[model samples]
Target: MALKSPRFASNAALQNAARSAPPIRRGANGQHVAAIQQAFIDLGLGMAISTKKAGKADGIFGGETESRVWQFQARMGLTRDGIVGRDTMAKLDELLPTAGPPPKPLPPAKMTHKINVHMRSIDNPTVPEFTQLKVMEEIYAQYLIRVDVLTGQSVGLTPGEQFTLNIVDGDCKWDQVSDEQRLLQNSGSNQGVGVNDIVVYFATVLREKNGETLQGCAGHAPTRPAVMIAASATDKTTMAHEVCHVLLSSSFTPVHVGEDANLMCSAPMCTGQPAYLSVAQLNRVFASKLLHKL
Candidate 1:
């Protein structure tokens, strides 16, 4: 017979591991396995129903794992398809944090709209160093709202979701807390997140000469709550680019040249970096269709 998990160790110990940056794919014993028996255990989730079909203790995913994932998706208020994609991953990361339950909900899911979200916008905030970053956030936010409205799931923030910019200049300790953070901060000059409705954007020590090196970086959505991170608003173009990443993060991947519109335009159009004004201009209907399914 397969062995059951031992009892919970010190919450302090778990917190310590979390603080020291525990491994993402580990068991209660915190050792390597062919596959994770249940993800919840690693994330400090105990005795949750399995979403996969295999035996409850089976390492690989089965029906039970699927079920639990859907429940998680719903509780976290995401599009629950049972499959753990970027959106799901973002939600999980936001919720199953080793530090304990993730941060409190930023806002509640408002009216479920049947309308396709046309792009929305807010006045661009003024910032000298990260001007591009700010524009990117605004534009990016509009992009997500538009996509959610169109896809029939406006997974953006509710009203009152505030955004704060926390800059830890020369504070090496900020990156020293945990492995996950250190890993991100090591390469996170262009990352940001929507905390509840409050999107907290991050800029790292690497943002020099206005984040030109990170223009290629795109936003990512993991399984958890609706959160995202983008490049700082220091560079002139960083804001717009990062905003595009943040808004398009959940339903879309900002990278993937194949996803770009095939519109034949008189206005300048760089392969991946097109001014995303109207979806009507998008010649790639196939990509747009695929985005909704995601």
Candidate 2:
């Protein structure tokens, strides 16, 4: 069914109803969603703020809206849990303007890249190809980029080819493996990809620099644009996090200390939370070589 447009009964009635309503969550729909969407816009965050794209405030608490909620929570130093509970709503009420010139919208980036993502796996046969593609779509939507995700046949995990990675303390380091072995593992499982494409490899496990188990890896290659996501992490945000790395490259630091909620923050404090890209990181992605904005 089509989500109805926001219909406020009256300014006073709307405020009272929203102020007294229960917490809002994913899949919520109705006037409350509309009021919250308007609140985000009033705060200068824009519509579909998490995606940073123009979209209707169509009174449905879908993924994009959920993300924006968490982003708002993060910025406000609230719980960052993505739930629009009473506390969050109260904060929103306090911050939203009573009346004034509407906050200025962020200017659109001049360039937007149209890119492709190729999926590959090694020693991990059952890659979450569809789920990962959905992640890429949602993430690119944030930057207003068009993405084409291409799935490749699964490879490796053969009886003799399965190699156990070295683990240091609690981390698993794939880089500890010989360069030749890493090259062979990546190359042998490869599928043809496009010039403006990134190869996403699903691995059984990923390790930190010291060989501690990490969630994923993202870096540039002479012949390929690549990011590796550990099938084990299981957090929905991990894939998008690594992809942000591939797009932002070394120009930006891997982590932002004060901005733990930003997509690029690798701090332990930010662990376990969904991450959103900072405006600067969004601009860097637009300027990156990996994307030939079309």
Candidate 3:
């Protein structure tokens, strides 16, 4: 069956309903809840919400609906409370109109790269693994490059490994291999990480020698190319930023760019901007040893 466009009296009405006592939460059933569910589906989140027998939004708020709400909240940087409150309602109102029909599937890409992610069990990353992968996929799709997750897993860490997880004084020295970095990168179980694949470690905390915390860093052993991401900094763009570092490598002079919208911009400045790459940067990325022609 075709998806029916969601109808609401008005954004004001939706907000009013969301502000009502008791709130619109799980187990509630009505057109309002269905509208929210349909909004998620329209936003290309159908895989997470469509579990009903008919595989459609059924005006029922169940486990699937609640999970979808949590995912949506995570994406919007809202509290993942699984409730449609004032804030969630506002975000829904702000984004729903832009949530047109999902894009048609694309043909096979001419170039591709594999990402091997090892997430620490203790890290408890803010953004979910699948969400992070989706973000990377969307950013790279613009360049006609396909980003594939070669392996993803949660692994426990030893006390010693946990203690030394932070990049110390000499760890960020990109010119030579650092022991601290090598130990951390090789601490977790290997997931068939290939020479050409980019390895990403979602650690509990990625700190600099100066005691400043970092969102993500592309520091790795000479042979093992990887990026370390702080659990708290797993926003939509951090992974992409670090991955760009790996692709650019040390040969690219001035690794960090000054443009806020560019992917290579320094942290915090690049926080909320739309990630973009220039023609010259794309040329550098395509020339990397890791990116392969499909």
TM-score of each: 0.25, 0.55, 0.57
| Deviation from native of the Cα of residue 89 in model 3, angstroms | 44
Point to the candidate with the largest TM-score. 3
Q: What is the lDDT of residue 45 in candidate 1?
A: 33
Better candidate number, 2 or 3, judged by TM-score? 3
Tens digit per residue, CA lDDT, model 2, 15-72: 4434545457777777668777777766665553333343656777664566667657
Off by over 4 Å in 2: 1-112, 123-127, 164-181, 267-275
How far out, in Å, is residue 243 in model 2? 1.2
- The local lDDT score (0 to 100) that residue 205 gets in candidate 2 is 62
Instruction: Rank candidates by lDDT, best first.
Output: 3, 2, 1
Which model is ahead, 1 or 3, in terms of TM-score? 3
Off by over 4 Å in 3: 1-122, 166-171, 175-177, 267-274
Instruction: Return the lDDT, model 2, position 189.
Output: 56
User: What TM-score does candidate 2 get on C-alpha atoms?
Assistant: 0.55
- The per-prediction tally of clashing pairs is 57, 6, 0
Per-residue error for 263 in candidate 3, Å, reads 0.9
In the range 76-141, model 3's lDDT, one tens digit per residue, is 667766777767776666555344653442233343444344443346678765677777776676
